[model samples]
Target: MSKQAATLEADPQLHEVFWIMAHEPALGDNLARIRVSKGLTQEDLEERSGVSVSTIRKLEQNDRKSARVSTLRRLAQALDVRTSDLFQPSPEPVSPLDESVHTDLFALRRTLKPVRGLSGIHMPDFDGEVTYESVRTSFLAANALYREDDYRAVVQTIPTLLLEAMTLVAEAGSPDSDRAARTLLSQTFQFSAQALIQLQQYDLAYQAITEGIANAELADDPLLGAWHVFNECWLFLREGRLEDSRRAALTTAETIEPRFSTGNPAEFATWGWLLLWASAAAVRNNQGDQAEDMLALAEAGAHRIQGQELEAPPFWAARGASTFAGFSPELIQIKAVEYAVVQGNTARALEIQDTIHLSGKLSSSTRHRHMLDVASAHASEHNTAESWAILRDLRTRVPHWLRYQSFARRVVDQLIEDRSRALRADQAEIATFLGIES
Candidate 1:
């Protein structure tokens, strides 16, 4: 039996603790084992990886459960392993009791990829008549929920939306109706994909995007397909497949490169959005020059769409005049701040943050994400009070959304670790909310 198993057997009270720890990334053990097998000391690995010796020690000793994905990438390159290899795979058939596995996620998974048998794939049953208008309305409502940061409602709404869209496709009578059904179905899948991505369910999100792309193809909508590919790039980034992310974004962006002079707002916005994703992947992968080039291209796209909020083509929903998809000047600035933070230039990050006034031009989700980066920048500069203030404000504004942000948790963890005195009430509250033991 494993040492963990033996230890759990020896002490019942330790069971819960061990169970929780088991779900965390097994980076420490993986690092130690890989380093030993390669016949390298910690110092040797540090020299090769350029990760600090102290950071390596903390990781290997299980004192740290997380590190920047780029740090893991460096170590993986040095060890000749995939970046994913440095973390343990999540246990299969995840426990229903696992806090991360919401019932709605399971519902979504079943709706997206139902079990198949010898006969064929089983389709979900819908009692109500599924009309094109009904599906469209539901899709818009779900998108609104997503924009409002009502994720739980979004998750609960998707299964029915998926079923309705699927039913509409199966029952579509005419050629035009069939195409319309497929278009809406593709969009529904995109919404599902985005929701899953927000919940950090990469594998499920990929499945959703793949299905969406297939539907987009059936509808002969390349722009819609490009949008799906954009989500895939995001999934790649979230999974730490930085090179894959960059390549996918760049390739798709080029395929749909808009003509600035003649292109509609949607085309420019979609293209710009893809370029931003590419830039993000490049920046995170340590290709600063490439990242800048991509960012500049994206900025040009944003300029082309200036003073306009263009809903990217195959519009998912009407989110009002102020909302849009893909690229905006504000989003570009946000990316600049994110890149500055990634480069460890905290001062530059804050300076960029100082210039932007919060405008309705960006969605609440986008604004909250930017705030997290600002908070992280403050934390990195050892400005804990400002960091705490940001966290507190975010928590107040988007409590449910704030809880799921791993970056926020990391920032809070750092604050707790670096504090010279006992945890302040606000710090303790944030830590508890994030499930971090203070």
Candidate 2:
């Protein structure tokens, strides 16, 4: 077993490091072991975790080596173990394998190569390879789920594939392979970041966007850079940094020059989306002139690519808008939030909250955004019970994968205070919901 695995096995507090080092699918092995130790089957994991039977089977075989963190966590819960338990090393045998076959089996296991290339590009120069088969299989599962439009599954698979790809690149160490893997990882980050944003994990998505910006710059890919900027702006907006978000979005929108050619419709669409979102942020910031100008530019840009199809030739061709109602929902959400805050229309804000897609694999930053909205809206209504309820719910979810450093906790704390301010004699329910003594 690797030092990481051993360390994790020995120290539960440091298990997260093991997850980072194990290259994604290691969670599967850990989950399988825990389940079997409990005398459970793949079907049992599926039934308990809400993961598909096929997924459970693949995980058991180590075929789906890159299952999502959330999926693994659920399985861990079902198996009555901490998610950290998945990072522990394989347990040692109580007794050595019977005399004659043990040595041969050990030799065979040691010599057998994993399905992926042992290239140093993917992972560090470690004891063994992370197996290309592992990464590829995981990628396929993710792509399959994406095609099926299963947003939850797609979000879960992205990070796993990214981790697997990183391991492969570290191991291979080929410049060309590294570049290719980086490109793949960049795509994975884009998907994951957006999914995280949708899931209301703003902080985690923000971190992803930061890394994504650096990667895009390294790759010298303008479109990728623009995408990262858009996500970064989205995060800023969610954080109520309206001015900063608008500034970022405006920058992306204005830079659509030589690089925003017909070859990359996605890039152009991103620019247009940024303009639209920026306008909304500007409106929130009370920059009326800026908002109007941006909105006009947004409409023009959207029209420019309305009917065209993306063609990646010597020069990229314009493609029509993405089918996701790309920028409309974001604009609506920002406007609604602004209206709620300004008019103190708590009911309106709460109603609008249902429209934003959130939960499961969302970046921590994005989750914070939704949580803030819930807290703020309820507080505005003087509904201490409701606000405290949301805060308590956040407390439950925060410990699962709250991996980012942001003001999320501060916002929750503020909400708690807001609820407490309005407490009545019989408001022990609110206190209990806030996890505070009555």
Candidate 3:
């Protein structure tokens, strides 16, 4: 081994630091480097950014891992850089070990991204006969499973569904049958991509969405292609490609923008959904005016839809009904609360949360995300008890889903750090669940 390697091996902490730096730039390190490069002292930064000197010291000393988005935005403004610049790290490549660990999804990976050779593509080997009706039914069942937050079941169901749809496409005899088969196949890919995203398998999710978009185009369905683009924007947001997310969403929304007097409700809902995600991306990127504009446009679309749950093509009744739970005035309100939280207006977030009642209209995942924002808002106000209550309830209700949410982990970490005394039993349990050192 090299001398540097020997030094790192001698100090375990140094080894870990080296590993982290190799994968992603440490946020604390980025903050310190940027501050110094600007010739700003800790006190100077504290005064300019309105961040406390103690907090600045801790961040520079690597005692903290992250700050809230609003805090990052303020610091970035002081530094004259984008908020994303502070969190900059080279893109993390998906590890092959991830596939080995998720062995159950191997078939799915094969189905979504088959091997291509000079001779021809290596298609899934299933020889079973499949009809369009059967494929549609399977797609609906899998979509419902996703909506119910049964991700394990959805993952298990997707590979077979994909194979069956592919079989139908391969064996199709008529143009109408071929179109039907490809349409269902595209929808299946969409559902598969959504499940993969929830499982945090982003690389596979990208493949699935890309395949879906291609199939949609082949089937001559621009609306279906638009839906795929919408989900792609979502994937971009989750990956911290905020500018890509905003641009894609805005461009697609403009392309599909509906006329209030004559547009179909489906058009209105799809347009609204894209705007909502654009708003989300903008707010997280600290573009307050752009965020507000996107939100207003979405709210107008929701108003045009007039509480009607627009049906999705192929089989589902409502557009994004299974995943996003459809775009509605209430859904718009949920997003408003999310924006408020990102802006550090916890009071307004909670106020809006209290007024909006989703009942059973939204999916569990959507509802849970909103609840996370509520918990975050409460925590920011030093209402630890209320925050813990919300988090505990969500953990009890959807433990599997909660485990994958980095946002939930962040909130739990903040709660643990803010407490002066030893963790209570419930606090310790949650901390353990979120993998936070308490």
In the range 74-125, model 3's lDDT, one tens digit per residue, is: 7878898866677653354232223434787878888878899999899878
What TM-score does structure 3 among the candidates reach? Answer: 0.88
Q: Which ten residues in a row have the lowest lDDT in candidate 2?
A: 9-18
Give the lDDT of residue 265 in candidate 1: 85
lDDT of 2 by residue, 1-438 (tens): 222222111110100111222344565666677888998877877888787788788866766433333455466667766444665322221111123423332221221222356663232223435765666566656655543434445544554566666667556667766655555555556555655554444555666677666666665676667766766765555444556777887877678642534524565566766776676665444454666677666555555565565332121111111222233334335445534543335688778876767423222333444565566666657765676566556545552222121222323334554553655643444334333343
Candidate 3: segments with Cα more than 4 A from true spot: 1-26, 58-63, 93-101, 316-319, 323-325
Query: Model 2 compared with the native: what TM-score?
Result: 0.42
Which candidate ranks first by lDDT, i.e. highest? 1
Q: Taking the candidates one at a time, how many backbone clashes does each contain?
A: 0, 40, 1
* Residue 310 error, candidate 1, Å: 1.8
Q: Write the residue-wise lDDT of candidate 1 on 1-438 in tens digits.
A: 222211111110000001113434477888899999999999999999899999999989988655765476578778987555676644331221234447767788788789899999986677899788888888888888876766678878999999999999999999999999999999888888877766656678789999999999999998888888877886666555667888998999899998878998877877887888887777666677898999999898888788875654544633211234535787889888888877667799999989987777676666777787888889878998999999999889888667656567667867887788998787789888776777
The per-model lDDT (C-alpha) reads 0.73, 0.50, 0.73
